[model samples]
Target chain A: MQIQTKAVNGVLTLSLDEKRLDSKLAVGFKDKVGELIASGNRLIVFNLSAVDFIDSSGIGCLVTCLKLMGPKGKITIWGLKPPVESMFKLTRMDRVFTLCSTEEQALQAVNS
Target chain B: MNQVSLTIDSRPENVPLVGACAKEIAGQSFSIDKLSEIEQALVETVNNCIEHAYCGSEDRQITIKYALSKDRLFVEITDQGKGLDPQCLKKLTAELDYNPSDIDCLPEGGFGLNVINSCMDEVNYRREDGKNHWSLTKFVVPLT
Candidate 1:
């Protein structure tokens, strides 16, 4: 999985540059986020605009990241395509994670 | 009707390959939405087989057979590993009957079977001759 990261107003925005976030890339995705968290980056936004497919393992990776970040660390996600959005809703993960429609909204969510 | 079969190692890396194959086969007749649903169900079923049936054993093999008719698409996923436990299947079916809205009580895992059940039109499981077989069907009208 290719992830592009940028820091804006102390918020780390990691954009997924892949079409699918399935089991194949779940472990690597988790590791990359782990590295970012280790570097003291707490407020994170995942831009998933390009990803159209995600499976259970992919969802598990995100949950794992959220748990690792703990309560103080904030993680927001935006740019979820409809199918991917539906998966989050089906598993009720949409409730657990902060979801936004655009990057700006996600930034505001993390900032708030 | 047309049919295609795929055999892959029981590994996470092989999932995308099999998924692509399924998409290509199903895409021949169904709309993108239907294809997406089938792919989602297919991934969940294959993932379950890899995780539970094979238990990460790379040596094990998974065979996926796709049969496409005018009105429906049929998929059979088979693994020659430990078959599914009947009690667990019953429990999962029960869990899928209710959708919990509470995030605090939301389950992290054990949602794959539910996803499959929700996406596919019909789902059945059987174990015979030391092989676990999962049959999934999706009814669709071919795109004009």
Candidate 2:
């Protein structure tokens, strides 16, 4: 999995360039999120526009990123497609994270 | 053959393939309950192997075996890594002090073994021949 990070208006936009996030890629992705958190970027916008699938481990990684950010920080998701959205709904995690329609909307939500 | 075997690399990208294999069998008519249980347990168990089993190794493989019968389905997943310590598992189950707030603190990814234990009718673990062998079973619930 490849993770690219860009910051605009205090929102750290993380684009995941992979097809899925399961056990195999969770750790590496977790570390990247950790790095962002450690870098004092409290507001996060995850662009999963490229991710087509996500298992529990993938969801776990995102949850861990949120926990790592603590209560004062926020992480939002944008462009969640089919199976990944199904997963979030199955676990009731869609209610937990901020879900936006597009990357631009996600950045706006976080920036605002 | 009594069972179907699938080989998956230790990479996270194969999670869907593993899930699809299990789901194909479990997602028949009115199999939602079973699908939910199997998906949760399978992901948790497989994630355990992926995140902790081979922790830092890149050349290892995780082998998954599936067996279906009229009454129950059996799943066995094996990983090429240092086996887990029974004593540590005992400690994890024995101690209930930590609040399950953070995802990383979870023993098995998000839902952890608790979900596996709840979803599957039986769960067993053993270490043999330098491999971690974890087994899970679920009985097909009769139609009401």
Chain A TM-score of each candidate structure, as shown: 0.96, 0.95
Provide the TM-score for each candidate, comma-separated. Answer: 0.91, 0.65
**Model 1 interface RMSD over true interface Cα atoms:** 2.8
**lDDT by residue (tens digit), candidate 1, B43-114:** 999999888998878778999999988889999999998878787776435544333334334455787987
Residue B140 miss distance in model 2 (angstroms): 1.6
Candidate 1, which segments miss by more than 4 Å at Cα? B95-106, B141-144
DockQ of each: 0.47, 0.25
Writing each residue's lDDT as its tens digit, candidate 2 over A19-85 gives 7776668789899789889989999999998986677778878888888887678888999876567
DockQ (model 1, Cα): 0.47
Structural similarity of chain A in candidate 2, as TM-score: 0.95
Chain B alone, model 2: TM-score? 0.81
Pick by lDDT: which candidate is best? 1
C-alpha lDDT of residue A30 in model 1? 94
What CAPRI grade goes to candidate 2? acceptable
User: Model 2 compared with the native: what TM-score?
Assistant: 0.65
| Candidate 1 lDDT score at position B12 | 87
